[model samples]
Target chain A: MNQIAETLASEHIHRDEVGAKIGMWLFLFTELILFGGMFLAYAVYRFSYRDYFALASKELDVFIGLINTLILLTSSLTMAMSITALRRGNKKLSLIFLSSTIIFALLFLVNKYFEWSAKFNHGLFPGSNDLLSLPRGEIIYFGLYYVMTGLHAVHVIIGMIILLFMLFYIKSNKVNQDYYIMLENSGLYWHLVDIIWIFLFPLFYLIH
Target chain B: MEHKNNHIVGYGTYIFVWLTLVTLTALTVTVASFDLGGFSIVVALIIASVKALLVMLIFMHLKFDDKIFRIFVAVAFLTLMIFIVLTFSDYSFIR
Candidate 1:
């Protein structure tokens, strides 16, 4: 009878772990909705002023955008490799790949900063700018551009911080081969960031 | 913790994604050089959707996840689409 009772208690723990995973997935769903709203707005505006949006997109630096895309794709690859390493119990390899992923993310942000500053210098900012001297609809186009990409950048920063936390968790042995829920979740979030950029690249930089 | 990385489909999907992205990028640039009129936005968005699907299915591992989670994501997207369509209708009907 006592053995039966102990078994039930351990079963409860496993159930709780699965429940926690579901909760995390639900939170991630909410984030998807949030980003989804922005994307919807972008689609509507782009549809309304197709010509103006395309012209505005041409003003963007495609080379910089392409470089950022490559950087993000590389980071995603590293992130996936990190997760694989964790599952394989290769703690050292996991940490190394995780660190590289973080570094690539920072490189992406730096490139974004330069691209944004150049846009500002060229008077292509939202609201009041020389770029707005075109049709009134183009003004709204740039507005969506800044808002969507800016929000994505904010996410990248948040993702970087999460990666930092995961890094520490690994160092303290809280995350290991037997248990790497944090690492897996962080990788999912990182991939979400990359996914957003995948859309943003075409919408903002290649608006054909 | 001894799982094997035997998901060949996932890796193959990533390769396909890279190729598609490159092709679509080039296609968009080429299309932009011409005068596609209003159809350009539609074409661009369709290409973007293809890219999004590849990333979501492969990189995010959504293809092999629980069915309930997949339903949740689908519902969220449907809700967002409904909201956008309603708002756009209002905007179009006003004035």
Candidate 2:
């Protein structure tokens, strides 16, 4: 009976290690398609309205976008390191790195808030008269801008929530050196979000 | 049972990749400031693709993970490319 019980437990853990990761990757692909659809829309519109897209893109503040990009890239670094720290059995350092990642994520969101607020104050949002009065291309530009970045921001929030749960799991020793698929999966999600911003920063902010 | 997190990356590697990514970000920003016209978007996208590759391989550990993950990523991007191409082919003939 003891032999059978041990076999079952070990087999369960073994299956979970790879199976969980595979499952996470599959989910990430679906997310890619979701964002890819938006990207497709942006592409078609931009191709049709090249000059207007360039003109409208200038309204975005490059400095803010640059800072947010750096923050997200650094957050991704810290997230990757956190998993490494955990795998090395240094729980405290891992926790610190993970916490820093969360902090950076919040900072990115704060920057985004100010940036969007400035646009809103200018009445540049969708359905605003100011936006309506703009050229047709610029109108579509701002529309894609809000939808894409807003969706990315929502993803940032989701990544934070996932990492926060990872913190609790690590603290409880539920996700330790031997079993940390949850932490790794959360890191994957965070990196995916970072990757999305990587494309977004160029398409929206740098095109000007 | 052997753990999946067996291939451990050091702090140095992550830091190195981070520095490269930052430098590339700076490079992309600088490149965009110069009005290279059509080449500007091309250059910016190339740089962005490189950065994304680094993040996926190193930070995301697709480098060390199972082959299936990489295959799935490749397939996903390929599918996205197909959609983009098909849409453009249709749109290009519109006018």
Best by lDDT: 2
What DockQ results for candidate 1? 0.39
lDDT of the candidates, in the order given: 0.77, 0.92
- DockQ of every candidate: 0.39, 0.81
- Candidate 2 CAPRI-style tier: high
Clashes of each: 0, 0
What digit string (tens of lDDT, one per residue) describes model 1 on residues A34-61?
A: 8888887777676677778877777888
Q: What is the C-alpha lDDT profile of model 1 across B20-47, one tens digit per residue?
A: 6667656766675676766766786777
True contacts kept of each: 0.43, 0.89
* Residue A206 lDDT (model 2): 81
DockQ of 2: 0.81
- Per residue, candidate 2 scores C-alpha lDDT tens digits across B44-94 of 889999999999999999998888889989999999999999999999999
Q: Candidate 2: which stretches are off by over 4 Å? A: A1-14, B1-5
- How would you encode candidate 2's per-residue C-alpha lDDT over A78-132 as one tens digit per residue? 9999999998989999999999999999999999999999999999988999999
Return the top candidate by TM-score. 2
